[model samples]
Target: MYSRISTVALLARALSDQAESYDYLLAGAGTAGLVIACRLSENPKVSVLVIESGPDVRNDGVVTSGNFSFTGANDRVLSYRAGKAVGGRSIVNGMVYIRGEQAQFDAFEKLGDSEWNWDSLFSYGKKGERFEGPDTAQKTAGVTANPADHGTNGSLTTWKSIGVNPVTDINGGNPHGFVSAPQTLDRDKIRRSSSAAAYYKPVDSRPNLKVIQGNMKRIIWANEKKNRAVASGFYAKEEKLGVKVKSAMPGVGENMQDHNAMVIGYGTANTLVGDTPFATLVTAQDALGNKMPVLAASSRSQISTWAQAASTYTGGAIDAKTYEKRFQIQHDLIFKQNVTIAELFPTNLGSAIVSQLWTTHPFSWSSVHLKSLVSFDDPVIDPNIFSLQFDIDMLVAVARKEQKAYSTPPLSTFVAPNQVLPTNATDEQWTAYVQANAGNTLHVVDTCAMLPLDLGGIVDSKLKVYGTSNMRVVDASVIPVELTGHTTGPLYAVAEKAADIINNDS
Candidate 1:
């Protein structure tokens, strides 16, 4: 009877009294969380409550200007302390907004649900986008953009807001080639376009939506009704309270995936000019003067190159045959259509031109789970980054390509050969370097993956939690596999679609 629940999100502090009941009580005001909240509350009759553990630092100068460290959760490959700010990672991220290959999304349908194909998600992707096409100065530096391929209207936007095979406009669904990344900045290239800025700011005035700055400590559980797996709720409480385990869904926090990345440097013939990382800086006199030309990212990428002969790692319910069907899409994208598999970009750090690269189609597997019975304790986020031999091989091939890039006419003119970098390095040296240095790109997904129940899936095509009557996960965690682009763009698409699903059900 509770299956038709809907939720909408905004980070407005609980202005007055907390309501005794709400149509939806969302545990997070995160990336997709707020998007779902906002969409669900579109119906004025539906009351939505968004709970945020972090403070609302929406316009805090310190938060906007730079980054701060938060202590919690360490990956097995390395330690990265990510904070839970009001806007989630969008506020403190690199602000690179990009879409993965079309085939990648289309493969989602094959993996489990027909409704999750790229064609449908492609629209949702553009739904929240407010794309700012490359300006004349940007175009002068080899930047290209398709105006039609971008959305002119949306809350999450440039200011607002791959691959081994080479294709133009990764947002067009086929990620390949060397191209400039799409930014999540505004028209002036100042201030990051977070979900708070794009989706919530305008709608914060809505009477039906409310946000509280605090953690959701527990959900008072109810007895099983209609003989359901886990009926009504799940909870967290003091040990003395002694909560009993209701049910166990083995796929709660398994099947984790993240892009393993490492930065390789090249000694430059000329001393680096700008403080920001990149090949060249395009500038105009903004309010802060021309000291810095607003930071932007440029990358050269290609397919994994080993696509034709790549192997898959199969376990759990996804047997060899099922895994083969899943991997065959990636193989065809690289070998058949020649889509870009890895992303390589240059950043001018210190005296060297550092090239940051990561493989997009990682088959390696890992898991993240709570360390103890406590709910709020940081989960053990152990991503076996180099779990696949294929990942290392891909990084080596990308390094080889970078060597060629450094040897090219213009770059060769000013860049010196690396004394201890991937430039001109041997395959053996590259492999060792990758194994020692590779870390996450922060493009993580699939922990609470959406797939078939027997296939280690925690959520369904509608994103409803497997055993729960009303609870659903509408974030990157529900994604079943890695894709060619950053998780941000696709996550927004996922939320957009999720909102519609919830609203329709309501």
Candidate 2:
């Protein structure tokens, strides 16, 4: 229903309706924008205009795979909201569903305000949930609903994948084993449609709901005081076919941020060590039913067996060389309870795809800010990946730990048999390797945080922008604390509750 609004018509309408502003003007159509738009428009009386910087995601095969198969389908929009796309990044994520640790949110409370504390904020976490998993790991991992942990009925269709990767434990036996299972994706199809698809797509028919496609340039305020400045709207321009792309007028821009990642590649199959002090927070053991000794490394491991049933490329979009490089399989392992997960992309090609070590829950911080004078043009992104002190230290330690896991009996027998990761195996050797490799998990967050305004927080406890009267942020951006699970599930819950709050207030 929203796919019809064009740049020309949108501009014409805005010029004519400056005085009678939309009850709500949400900038960007990524995770947060979709939620705010869907929730606010539940009431037919209030007019809500959602400005997206990209195109719709209705028929994109790459976005639908909802798995690793299509993760790189679209270029990363580190610059602006997933350019005008209706679904935003939810259309491009690992699809793993997880909630932040209770202690984490409690820390937010300690660092800032009561409204952000675990006690008060837990409800919203649950409210946005649509639990369809068997809760296999729930009891084992101490993840259960206490009214604050989960929600039963939400608009998003959340569930465990009917199809699971070989690495994940489909049956709730050993809680520690790595299993690759599809999350937030339907097994019947490869695509991972987001809440925007399930929730907003169905209700765009409402007259009050108007989705306009344009590059959001800036966030214009009505007054001088930053907090008092009511967010009026944003500037937008159409992309030119070939001629000069028109410049948009300067105004307010949407402030976005995300976590940057550094992937560490190793030469051998070995277990990485977990964060020392951090180990106490977890409980680990060998795969259930297997007598194999459980290595205490710090990363999580998953065995993914899913491959694109059909060739991803029709002609030569991806040459055979590229396909071989991306599709090689290697053994996987998890260490240190489950802080990180490692995948071994095996290949007889060059060095033999040994083990690919990754630092889960990386501590790096970065952002997505506007590039031009307008917020609508793609935002400039640095993800300033690897900026945190703890981030580098963790990489060094994990590399050492993985080397140890490879030394174990059963795994060692299959691994280089003798040639393992960190071959020289010393603090120096591991450190050099760490410095050389390490990319992002692509799990970005916290561009517009939800907390009290006093603590440098943009959004309030209710997820509303602090200074605004009627606006709210209901996507991954509103998430103040980092989530232990992937961001999509939590985003769903956030949007669900946002809908309730707006509806109740209306």
Candidate 3:
């Protein structure tokens, strides 16, 4: 073992000695990369190297503050935020940890990814989490839990929000009603518990694992046959540090998706105050109740229409039948399985409840493409938000329902006599407002989707890139479908499962 003082130098010498190849080369030292590296490095026989674009931010106060800000790509159209440090977005995101609806995972299984499902992923979810059950104060506040769904021995720590009742286990495949879920935080320290803190920090002394800071230029394909390209390695450049490195990985960067969100702030007269901004959340069906069936039926046809458009957009990369099958799975999750169509974050803002709304699934697809093969340029990102009319319509309906909720009973009594954001705004106006003000939740996934190659999938169920050897994508990019919950929980589960898969394969 190398001492703390000599570790960096030793790591540099090791990298210099083994510059040509590594047992495993990870493109980004973010959430997925860190988890995989730590897990793989457990075996002293394997050599692991992780290349990150950002600096070592393990002790940076600003990055570890648990507060969020939009970085990377911020524009009028889309304000995209992605953490550039070792922990990635986990360091900056709202720490709400939800396992997502069972139906959403089932949809992934139905997409011909047999290995993916609720039960299987749920086990992985537990594998990566260490649940900090409710304390005395929290228990009195109504926070209950199912011990079976929680893990006692895991890397990440989860804690219940104070003064909130845990109606049901959100991980028990049903999160319909109001429930107090866990957050990825160090309750004792009151600080963010990111993947880097939980996974990387523990194993930083491992001699086999080496993490280098540099921006990935592109995947160097050994064979570029358009359809049968094989990955050899990647080129990276860090100008500030005057460092450049080339490492191997064919499936470096591909398939990208993000959660699109819009906030509907409502001013009220109630003096609601709480340290936690939002501790309670309700699914769309729970919020809409009996009036959901009609709207669900009306939206069914749009699935096929979207599939057709998606197929055309891909230039037949995915067949019409495949596209329809993929979209139909999503349709079932939303309508039949009752997956969350929209999420509402009711923040008690002194004199208002800024009801943030987020659409669970959007038909739009975007990409992160390299501008050139040789240059270390930033990847061109196009988050085609509101490309589909259905997304806009769904958001509009969510806004309308939120308005209705504000006007009802106990909630209405707290509201100010006057309405904010025009309570009686027409459908046209709401739609226009959503279009102009909506932004992404930074929960991006599915760029290098894990589906069969015939269905436009970049990676397989095992996360291996389809036409290559020794290249895998174990990040949010492999998620085939958009999920109802935040990306952190699912991604932790994915990385845990990915480690097992890789170990088993080896």
Best by TM-score: 3
Candidate 1 lDDT at 408 equals 59
Cα lDDT tens digits for candidate 3, 1-506:
00001111112323343234466777777887788888889999877778777778889887566554232113365656677888877877888787777888877777778788988888888987788887886666556678888787710011122112234566677765455667787766767789899899999999888888865544555544455444555555322333223332222233355666776666677676653323344454654567668767776767677777766766655667776787777777776766767666665567776666677777676667665544444567777677787777777766666666566555666765334466677778777777778878888877778887767787778887765555677888788888776888899999999898888886
Runs off by more than 4 Å, candidate 2: 1-21, 69-84, 117-123, 126-130, 134-182, 218-227, 233-369, 374-378, 387-389, 406-420, 451-454, 466-468, 504-506
**Candidate lDDT values, in order:** 0.62, 0.44, 0.68
Error of 2 at 310 (Å): 48
Clashing pairs in 3: 142-165, 233-248, 234-247, 254-447, 255-447, 255-448, 256-447
Distance from true location, Cα of 204 in model 3, Å: 0.7
In model 1, which runs have C-alpha deviations exceeding 4 angstroms?
Answer: 1-19, 66-77, 154-168, 223-226, 229-247, 271-338, 421-424
Scored against the true structure, residue 313 in model 1 reaches a CA lDDT of 26
Cα lDDT tens digits for candidate 1, 161-242: 1112223365776545555677677746466788877888778889988877765554544555555443332122234344
User: TM-score rank, highest first?
Assistant: 3, 1, 2
Comparing 1 with 2 on lDDT, the higher-scoring candidate is 1
lDDT of 3 at 51: 75
Candidates sorted by lDDT, best first? 3, 1, 2
Pairwise lDDT winner, candidates 1 and 3: 3
